[model samples]
Target: RITESQNGWCWQGPVEVVWSNPPAQAGSPRVPAVGLHSTTALLQVTVEDFEVVCKGLYRALRIREKYMQQSLQRFPRTPSQYLRAIEGEVWRASDTGPGTFKHLEGFPLCLAEDLGYHVQMKDGVVYIYGDKAAADRNEPKDLPYPSLERFMDDMNFLLALIAQGPVKTYAHRRLKFLSSKFQVHEMLNEMEEIKELKNNPHRDFYNCRKVDTHIHAAACMNQKHLLRFIKKSYCLDADRVVYDAKGKQLTLKQLFQQLNLHPYDLTVDSLDVHAGRQTFQRFDKFNDKYNPVGASELRDLYLKTENAIGGEYFATIIKEVGSDLEDAKYQHAEPRLSIYGRSAEEWPKLASWFSEHRVYSSNMKWMIQVPRIYDVFRSKNFLPHFGKMLENIFVPVFEATVNPRAHKELSVFLRHITGFDSVDDESKHSGHMFSTKSPKPEQWTSEKNPSYTYYVYYMYANILVLNNLRRSGTLLATQTLLGRKRSPVLQYLYFLAQIPIAMSPLSNNSLFLEYAKNPLPDFHQKGLMVSLSTDDPMQFHYTKVQCELMPSCCPSLGLGLRGPRFSGKPADAGPPLGQPLEQRGLCRQKPLAANTACGCRSR
Candidate 1:
């Protein structure tokens, strides 16, 4: 009942099973102790259990601290007597020995201060020093995690954190710059001030991805939450806020009202909007209603969108938000477009729209952020359209594509973009034998050999395009090289020509321990300028530590010493013949990886 499959996996009982064979030379297969139950899964499960325990412990400590503070009455004869009574009560209540249920040990005041929170029990009510909800990752900004009542209190805590050291004016950037420059003790004064001002900098965007170079308000903000109005006392007298460099307080609801435009997807409800601190009587009616914010204005902000109206809507918001916030003055931000749809066919029109209405301002000018460009590989002819659009559509200087999949087609494409092949005319079409595939090694006559010809033309044309774009600080390259399986020639050219690379785990690759992650540091060491960007933040299983990724995902996001890899035949005393690694059915360590991406030699 066993069958061999082309992809090296076996199927049985509606499931696919993979067999592993190690130490091929020893005539035996190695079975790891854990088998496919990798260490990564083990660590993830362990971390989750630990976090659950930590969260429960923190909650217990909070309850105990509150109860102890409430026990204090009309000033016990002396402060010492009051403290002693509270300590004795806690010791009796805490049943740490057998976990019948008891208070967890509380952190000292100094510890809380160091962590940027305060725990004080002054009045009958306990006031926490920080946003308690922020500690909970499951809390969504647009939707209350617990109930409406709890979220109101959490919102106040978040706002209070911001109010402590507000950025009232743009006069202090110079000091901030100096602090980040030296980052030493002498600049501690500026460093301290910068820290206070930049806390929750992503608050205005209503999102948490600070690594983003381009942002979209429509993608992050909830129109429903922005328009909701509750009694002033219910929200602690807070209202929806949108920051304007000119000091105009505009809310999502107000922005539409002022512009006199309505998008179709949102439903406006002003009833629950926060009113005065005056507690309402029982006669109040719920005014909150879902408004249609998803009108034509936001429909086509994504890439491959065919609707011109949608594109214009996206463009208008970018301009409107930029103008309102004066992002150029503060942070020099731009718009982002994630285009993976079959939209390369619509490039001419999209480019036309972007060209005529490119965003330009005195302090900042962002061409347009198109981060995902994977669909262009649908045809050999598709990529040149994108290359031409680089100039025609006024694309942002920086863009990224999926790695070099379909090396055969990409070979044709590389030639097309480099101008050796022209747009399909009566004389040239995609099927032309000249660029159908790389010329054979036997056919190689410097200009005819796919190896030499591809290397030469790609370097010549791409270098010109790259150099021009570099002057303006714009770049175009691949996002993930993990599964591309490109030939060694392509790998060498990418490095020699200095193409940018963004590393991301592809389909079926573990974010923590994929073999692809190994190439990242090697790429960097080989002088390939690379960037790490999240492919789909929502899909990844996030932990508190990984959420602030600098600590864990850096250098290598994946797990363990890559299982031992041996390439090619061992060296001998006689002189060796130079042949393709694939030709000899061997692996050789050159340009990092020993195996061809396709796991076969160039035919």
Candidate 2:
């Protein structure tokens, strides 16, 4: 006889047992058999060492659960239930979806009446006071605010846990075991799974719901699309004023003349917006690709939101991309728009551009990406301190939430925004290490950039309080893609928590890592929750159907049924209301059933 329990990577770990008894007497109560177990059969470590690792892992899960619960974010019920069971507590059914908000189902597009609350930022987190009186009294509303001290304490503990010798050894072995076990299961059950998939009817890859989780708004369309749009704009608006250079107006034709280029002569090669071998490991070059024909004026005119044309070109490009997705009938995309925290007016201007241009799309959900370029802002004297930058980024959202009627356009725009992303090159090293003694954001006036962790922490901290105030589900920065270099302990934690990752091997191939070196296949086989994404179609893809480009990478990477599965469960930046956030363990079956119900017909 054997007992099995769920392991960290969503697979079963078998516990062996040997019975030392004969048959029981007929019609009599059977005596329990003496149970014997092998010491080396289960854990390869000493019992004390195993217990120590187990305790550390349990505490880590608890830490995440606490943070997520307080922030109104989703924490999978399985781990929560397990934690409760370990503590000998009853698991209530109503507790399964703690982050669920009933109001999201039919959330209004129109502005709501203002609540007239006072919103303020202190220590990088927003606080909502009931009134000026409450602000004077230093009392915030009942919403929970995360303590920086406690967060740093938990962070230090987890950091220490990942570096511990025993924990590292245990996690590494466990991950290897999970990978090997998945390989064995695939060898034994791959045919049966395929057979089951094929037996299901009326569904194929074409009809399956696929989502492009990671894409930028400026480059959402392919080079061909951009080229055609440019030509069409020139043909129609050659005389229309489109740009203002230092208070002088320029039309489409004049702007082209100023840049020494013409739309009629522009080919894809001459467009020169695509990433190539030269851009590899050079993020600067990759970034420069945003400028068409090596001209920043073209980027500013077509790709910027606050240009003389009021971002008409950018909006039209996004609308066309959305229309393509709608035509595909089963595809969706979450495209990120940039929000440089140089001025508070940026939010209102972007919102007005969105509303004015009518950038509405059923197939598209929006996300705001804050670029980690504080040093650039500081060097230009655009910002006095990092704290002011944080204020510019988050304070507007807080005001919109607190007084929707006052900031009508921004309030409406915020409704479509599902999440926030901290975007930057990860390879760059910051000299500063974040800690309790580190300078506060207001005091961070130095020209050097802060560490990556510093940006992530403040972003999460602010988002945490914001979510608690709004009561919505947002996929936070925790679900990042590039975790291959992460410690074994962190990787194991990600597995346990079922964190979703959006991998862009094509984008990674051109800019950072080589395609052959991608860990996507290995992550998928090891049961890490991974999905495919075309990070920037304009730079990396040639196809008009940009979402389809990712699936082509699947076969070369040896992904069969896994490819469709990844497409089905896109890590949505913010799922519109009525789509419950995916949960793990017993709760995962609903979406798994839906994804597989379509069948792996292509595979």
Candidate 3:
């Protein structure tokens, strides 16, 4: 016989065989038994095979029992428990493999349903569809687990329960924990749910803090729609009084004051209403001042009014009247002229008016009046109201005509009015006042005289003034003293006239030509030379013709022609050729003989 073990290996009965002669054919031949074996050996072999088969079967049975125990353990102990656990699993596992519910198969359906779980049917298998069970199953789902929409719905429902108060303390704790773990949008969704369940019986049990939570969510999301909704419906004046977990309230109004949401001005209004006593008062005062006055006031008082008392009637009233009541105040006064040599009493009455109007005035007006007033003073020689007017009008005008020609004319006019000598006249005579005898022509060539220094300085000053005039375009339409467009020759003569004859010898013809062609009036010549003689030899070494001629050919000599002269006489009365040796007390007179031709008479 053969037997098979669970392992599938076969075992057969042991048998022995031996060789034998036929008994009928050979009576005389010795015969051996056809078969013989030791019974013990055979029995031992059979027992060994049976033992091996039995051991294999026993091992198989042990394995089967282990699997059975594992399967039974998976069965739900209670219907409710199973329903709740499996329902959730089913939903979660619809798109997943059955292996997903390997651990959840026996959970009671009643428990699963009570816990808000449901079964998802797919491919002839029911799957547990809940977040907790699915997580435990550790299996892939056929569809995404916990859809966003479904999650939101759940949150909304939970929030609604919370808002209805009498919330389970444990559930509320769990929700708070979830809130910390979840996103802001999720929290917002929960808040929306709470708002919806306004009439819930258990509302008192829920710690909604809906307004604060919604505001925080809105701030975090910064979503326009959500913010709009919160601002419109949820936020109250009291809600704006936000306090931190530590009990310190933040200054919400100040924080949001700069954010421009003018179209939603109502939000600001709401905030003001809810603001605490101090903040409410402050906001109210601000509002009252800014509120529009009647349209008639705007039309009647402010339009097209030049230099009006205030910005507008409303603005003026606010400045004058409202300022006294409000915390901030403004007052304006006219400029005073203490620096202009005026008595304080002479200041304008307008100063008081300006203060009354609370109009902001500047010193620019005073500056504009100065030049005109100075002109009047010059013409009149004396004004009884001079000191008073000066005191009243002390404004400084920074903006003068930048045109150089205009500036020069202004300066000249100022000098005329003040009876102050022109700068040119002072510079010319500065050298001659210290000298005694006229300098020799040769001595005049030396670079050591005050006259030469004065000449050079004056010429440089003129050039600078002319260059400035040119740049300012004030020179464009300049005319001669005779009131005709100045000829190039006269212009050149005028430029040369500014330089002492001694100095001209050092200037180049090109420079002369440039000056001649320049459109600027010869202001230096016109203003400086009216009384000063041009042909003074002691001051200027050369004759006028020589001075003019030298620049044409002898530019090098011109470079130092204005060098100092060494004379002892006033420049204007010096001899044409400078001092003679006789004038210096170096030679004695010689008597003329009767026969000698007298040089003086001969001439």
Candidate 4:
């Protein structure tokens, strides 16, 4: 006999049920799909509160999908399909077929002829017009121009949602469920995965391409590597004029004499670039580590890009790092170069440096990192206002995109550049909260620094517009932030959006948090799309294999041999969106068949 009940999907003996809708292609070889096959609603909260949470989450995902599509960035179709189904809309898969790029002599530099578009910056965002007439009429081209007011409204909603008691509790419980679910799955399938991995041929941890998603170009080399480079540079360019002290050019030897130091006497300990106990929870102390032997003169002479020798030494060191990655055959890195918005000319100077040095490596991509030191720049009277600083950071790139031929070097430089990063001390609290009531960027002329969210919103707004214009997408990935205690709503949102997070546990251990305190494992278990990164090898690492050391040392290194396998996952470590598309395969093999749970080719 059958009895009606409030609970759903109870099994009857020897009974079978078929779904009306067929399951989508799994895209991998047949493996037993593990899932919670339940129809009963597991509501931990009141029905009203649960409904509120669901609505908030749906709206949040929609907001992300809207922005991603507007900027031509990638958003996984799985969520989109679910969202569409909820809205009773059909979801069609769009094919972004194999794209191509033009390279000049092995560099991803595409020097297009020209596209005569009038570009101007307003409210800290670049606007493109067809001609002067269009500008006069206040009509810009048909691009996805970001609305600051709308952004502020959305931001405010999210800020409030995260603070809501119901949402927070619901998100915390959900995250806990995901973590427990992942642990159970791991325990049951661990042995089977290992067996599959052993039977697979020609694949192992060493052979897998591991990409260090976040690393600083200035500090890309470790202490020993930097020490070696310093001594070698001193040996080769001792008599070369490498420093300009108020117009008095000093040779490398003379510079060493002025700093009261000898290259021969400098050991890694003496170089003193590594972060130690003193640097823990001290950003200032960590920054001081950029200078060798505690000398800014040495930092300028060696690490800076716009310095006395046109950053020749810096370029050489980066090239050396790239060569090392190339030699390793399966390693890659995206090294960030700083663009302090002291002047718009910084771009041209940097582009010139890049061109003159021919600092191109097949395994290396470049990123431009803007330091949130506008207060420092403004305090020195270097910049008029926050808008000018933003202009210095982004305007030149807009001009290059508008007329590539006019700004050929920067245009080419932009090709090599994959993304932008905002670097700042997160622990420093700001008094201002970003909202519509807050001052516009131009009006933000106070010496006080803006909040982190303020900086991120403006940068994201500009990048959003710029990506639309360039039609070549760039993703914004947060490093070292996700591995900290964050707002539950924000954390859940990150998981839903699958935002790529590059975590540097060792780096965090030295600067902000201890190794045991890092949230990498929790974030990964909750499916936050986390990856391992070596933030600053020079400051945090002792070995030459910097990136490899991070995954190897971390205790909760997810996959056995690969550690954080997400380190090389395409969502986090793929080639730049502008690069020529290779095969649409995650694994480097041809015809990319679906893989087993062990990441081995399924036979």
TM-score per model over all chains: 0.26, 0.83, 0.12, 0.84
lDDT tens readout by residue for model 2, 35-135: 22333343376556666677788888788777666655556656666667667678775444333222222234545467788988887777889898999
Among these predictions, the greatest lDDT belongs to 2
lDDT of 4 by residue, 326-423 (tens): 88777777677789888999999999999889888877777677788899989989988899998988888888877777997877676667666666
How do all the candidates rank in terms of lDDT, highest first?
2, 4, 1, 3
Candidate 1 lDDT by residue in tens digits, 1-603: 223444332212101112233453352332222133232222232334333322332233233232222221011112223223334543332221111111111111111001222222111111223444543433312210122233234334423422322211111221222223333322334444344335535432222222212122233212333333212111432234432325666544454455475333334442222212221211121111111332322232222234423344445434544453344333222223333323433434444444445533322222122222212332444433323322222221111111112122221111111011111011111321223244322233231112221222222233233222212111121112333222332332233223334343221132222433434444443334343332222113123213432232322222110100010001110011122111111000011111111111111
Query: What tens-digit string does per-residue lDDT give for candidate 3 at 1-603?
Result: 334554343332211111233563332323223232332232333455444433332232222222212221111112222222323443232121111111111111111002222233221122334454664675423322222233234334433432332223322332233234333333335444344345344432112110000000001111232225324422433134422224544332422342322224544343321212332214233222212121222122222111222223323432332222122111111111112213332222223333334332110011011112222443454333332222222211000112212222222111101000011111112334212233322233222323322222222222222222112111110101221122222222222122111111111111122224321112222211111111111122223323443232122122222221100111221111112211111000010000000000000
The candidate that wins on TM-score is 4
Clashes of each: 33, 0, 56, 0
Displacement of the residue 363 alpha carbon in candidate 3, Å: 16
> lDDT of candidate 1?
0.26
On lDDT, who's better, 2 or 3? 2
Candidate-wise lDDT, in order: 0.26, 0.66, 0.23, 0.65
Error of 1 at 537 (Å): 9.9
Whose TM-score is higher: candidate 2's or candidate 4's?
4
Location of the lowest summed lDDT over 10 successive residues in candidate 4: 589-598
